[model samples]
Target: MKKTIGRKEKPYMLPYFQMEEDSFVITTWHDGQGFNLYTSNERYKTLERLISRLPKGTIIEND
Candidate 1:
């Protein structure tokens, strides 16, 4: 199967891997059961820090 980005309902798989910058992978569901993405907004800071360390064009997979 082809790797993909974005929610399954709106997948941008091939195009997502073609871009040079400013591309995003999105998901409609939260990681933890019963805890939405917004339930812990504070994690964004740490997450941002970690992501910033990655080289440009890096693709992160939650799984």
Candidate 2:
């Protein structure tokens, strides 16, 4: 009897951002005194840049 090898499934990547809305405001601070507004596309790019700058093994909390 020959044994068949099964293909391994790809590991699932945990979602760091919930980008469902049409527009996204990247960040705001000091009661809207200071803010950085970005479009949906820009938001994604900014997030990617921020993530890349972080040190390895950095765990992001999504609460």
Candidate 3:
């Protein structure tokens, strides 16, 4: 995995890890109270499972 920086636009981007094996860009940003994760649709299930371990007000939806 290669760590890289994302675009500096709206909502403020965060550092992302690039998976060359699957060509995926995974990143997470905070919105003061919670976190917003950005990734490919294929990882939705995996992401959901991971977020399940976190507190209810952690991951922000519709971000």
Most accurate candidate by TM-score: 2
Model 3, span 13-59: residue lDDT tens: 54666545435443344555545454454544475665666787874
TM-score of each: 0.25, 0.26, 0.24
Q: Please, what are the lDDT tens digits per residue for candidate 2 over residues 1-63? A: 333356555555542555666565556767955445455554346656656666999775533
Where model 3 places Cα greater than 4 Å from the true spot, the runs are: 1-45
* RMSD (CA, angstroms), candidate 1: 13.1
Window of ten residues with lowest summed lDDT in model 1: 33-42
When superposed on Cα atoms, how far off is each prediction in RMSD? 13.1, 13.7, 9.7
Higher lDDT: candidate 1 or 3?
Answer: 3
Which window of ten consecutive residues has the lowest lDDT sum in model 3? 19-28
In model 1, the runs with Cα more than 4 Å from the true position are 1-45
Estimate every model's Cα lDDT from 0 to 1. Answer: 0.45, 0.57, 0.52
> Count of backbone clashes for each model?
0, 0, 0
Model 2 bad stretches (over 4 Å):
1-45
Model 1: pairs clashing at backbone N, Cα or C within 3 Å: none
Candidate 1 lDDT, 1-63, residue by residue in tens: 434465345434442234334433334556433221222233343656656766999776654
lDDT of 3 at 32: 57
